[model samples]
Target: MLAFGCTWLYDGAMSRSDRFEIFLAAPPGLEEVLTDEAREMGFGPVTAVPGGAGLTGQWTDVWRANLELRGAGRVLARIGSFRALHLAQLDKRARKFDWAAYLRPDVPLRIEATCRKSKIYHAGAATERIARAITETLGAPIAEDATLRLMARIEDDLVTFSLDTSGEPLHRRGYKEAVGKAPMRETLGALFLRQCGYDGAEPVLDPMCGSGTFVIEAAEIAVGLPPGRARRFAFEDLAGFDAEAWQAMQTPRPPRDTPLRFYGSDRDAGAVRMAGANAARAGVAALTKFTCQSVSALTRPEGAPGLVMVNPPYGARIGNRKLLFGLYAALGEVLRREMRGWRVGLVTSDGGLARATGLPFLPPGPPVAHGGLKVTLWRTGPL
Candidate 1:
């Protein structure tokens, strides 16, 4: 599921009064970046944990995080936690837990459980117990494909329960139905924009635009659009999901009136057309221009220098590694000669490919796992 700040229907509705612990899951090495975004978005007392970021907020914050946060893969609302050493203790505690606080008796449910270094190592057994407890106490049915998931993790004898409030990853952004080979996820694209100092005040250009992920994301950020606005969320099915309040919360903000148009170009005409369609669906076509052009023919747009970012094809996913060097070299040469005062953010899986750019990029960032390949962002100051 995905969304944006534009108006959409409140299909799922409920009501709740619990103070939920919202966990915004980020990529493995980008926890700090996600945390900074949460803090910048006015989330209170946020904490960056090992695999994700943690914070305390109301149900509205949970909805806002899913709607507004571009960097979070998915948001998990932690309902409660306790210490249970064995299966009997787990069953006893599960029975006493207040399932009605969050879940509705009519909606179907799904349970996912994990155990690590704990006495109760049987994940399936734990799921069964929890399912039984919910069925007996609250009356929600269990289904394998239910969108509302109750996730339980037992570690060091501590049982933690969380609900998958964001049904699908936020990177979907409810637009961009068409994608090119090895397209960059929108969540990662948002962080890469941040890493390269993109503040939505300047124009952004992506020569190897693919389906125009970078350009569209830049336009959305500039206009204050939330990533979840165009789609419904799983949270709407839970108890206490005020539909009218959420609709009010997701109303579009006044867009910043910047004449600077974001630009994206691809050698494939089909990719360029797909990008244009996606930009239109995202409500930013007026502020973006996608063209069918190759990197060799790319010229600086008619405006002040802005961000020049690209997520090129990786060797593992596409063509041979050797042929890409010339492509990278040509890309580097074009930018260095024409786009003065422009910043660059290049995402690549191979260090050799990045060096081929020769763009005066500083040391690359920590390796991030994407599409099963370790990738990193190579950045450059004004060139």
Candidate 2:
């Protein structure tokens, strides 16, 4: 027999009256960074928790969050919760809850359940009861391949449900179909740029420029382009989705006028080509320049000094460990000699490698888990 779990219950069309708790997922150790972004984007009264940030908002906020926020992995809307000390109690409560209010009878449903320190300890049994209740009561079909996902967590005799409002992770910003080795995620790139005090008023340079993630992100921010503009979200599939309102909300912000052009350089011709193509797809081609050149050949662009950001090979995943020291030292020497007034933000897993740069980095930010390695952002004032 298939076990089941339940999702959110809403009264009707999502409106201001349908206020709920929203969770914005983030990378571990970067919760505070995401919080700052949410607050700046006008999303809170926000609070940072272990995995992400939380805020109380209505359905419009959820739509705006999916449309605008650049740092969240996905948005989860808390539906409701109840106490179910045992499987029987869970079955009864799930059946009686108003599943039909939010879930459509025709749309297939998928549920994930977790249990911790609860008398209804068997997650499978709890899931089965809830699933049965929804299927029997609401007549919604259950399918593993369903795009709409509901999460039910049972902790300390309390079962809380949340609906995943974003389908794909926000990092897949629907652009940059091409990526190089160990490319930085677009979400992390945005938050890191924020951490480095980049506000899109100045140019950005990435010497390694793996697929031009940082350069494109900076250009998009400068032009006031919403990150989710190119993609569809899971929220569109939910009941009460206002298609007209969402379309009106996405009316493009007027492109800002800036004289600066973002820059990226790589020794690999293929990487340079890939980065250029990605920038074009992201609609920032005119504001970005990619060149095939090594770090040794990198030069300060012809403009006011700006931020120099790079996520180079961490040796754990990309290059030889011992030889990377020379690369970092050489990068440090180049920046110190040529880029006198520029600020720098370097992301790497090794403190020693960061030290090898010999730049006057103030201090390292919190470690961020990326691709099985804990990476930290090392920043410096004007060089």
Candidate 3:
């Protein structure tokens, strides 16, 4: 056991220079996909972890992470790491951390802790201890409902702490005021696009476009829109954040008006309406066409071949799964008959439904954990 003392105190100062290790959390199977995206955005020494990736860089790199990197759910900057055998040790080391650099008395914050295979078996007690230390020592208040959340994890006597820079999950891109039943997340949609080899130059289609997630995300990618353009991030509230630099980073660009670059169709009129509303909010309504039509009614645009991405319903709820199998079959028939030579990416949690497609199955990449279910992302063609 470690003794608790007032020797650990923070004066709320900023260091002139520091480098941070960011652990980006992703959906189960998209670690490699996110690691590649981090590398493309200039993050170095990227490595894939179980649920995410790790990268090392400076504060500017953190800013760029908020600007770019669409595949991540949240970017967590590791603030402190040390070995702690019990609650006393955990509290002592957490107090010694330089919390004053990132937190302020005026800015509200909260801590979430998880313990595994360590002497500190109770997660709630560990979280309370650390929260009390920051509050009592650093003069930072403990907010019960703070948007900026810090995560603490203790495994094998090693404690690691991180601040979540992205407030909510990055998938809530702010344009989606409404959502369809069993809707896909925008971050997962972008990763599926990359899996299908979508480069934003080719046309994209979503036969079962729900709330226009895949279609709108594709249009935004094609037009070079930043994923985080519409919302505020937690980093904006940090101590050393440069408001002027952030404002300059928000330079508005004109919308792309390319015809048929994106197309979407849904059998439900309500879904089509919601999709159009979402597209209008995203400033890409002109570039996308959402129609109330079934998969059989889907037609190719007057242009070169593009990719078709679909997240068809699996029978997850009562009375829906059985009916959706036929729907998936119909979708496969339509794609096979009408969409030959166009690539296809389908996301579903049911293997039986995927086998029913009758289309030649290219083995799925990896299973992604979505909505508490393991879903496979299947891809076929360039045909």
The Cα local distance difference test for each model comes to 0.86, 0.87, 0.81
In model 3, residue pairs whose N, Cα or C atoms come closer than 3 Å (at least 3 residues apart or on different chains), thus clashing, are 315-321, 341-383
Per-residue C-alpha lDDT of model 3 across residues 291-353, encoded as one tens digit per residue: 999888877777788898988888873247778778778888888888878989888888888
TM-score of each: 0.94, 0.94, 0.92
RMSD of each: 5.6, 3.6, 4.3
Q: Deviation in angstroms for 65 in model 3?
A: 1.3
Q: For model 1, how does the per-residue alpha-carbon lDDT over 49-147 read when each residue is reduced to its tens digit?
A: 766688877888888899989899899877777788999999988888878878999999999999989999999999999999999989999999998
Kindly report which residue pairs in candidate 2 clash with one another.
3-128, 4-127, 4-128, 4-131
Query: Model 3 misses residue 307 by how many Å?
Result: 0.5
lDDT of 2 by residue, 158-267 (tens): 78878888878899999889998999999999989999999999999999998999999999999889999999988787766788999999988788888889999999
Q: What is the lDDT of residue 21 in candidate 1?
A: 69
TM-score of 3: 0.92
Off by over 4 Å in 1: 1-18
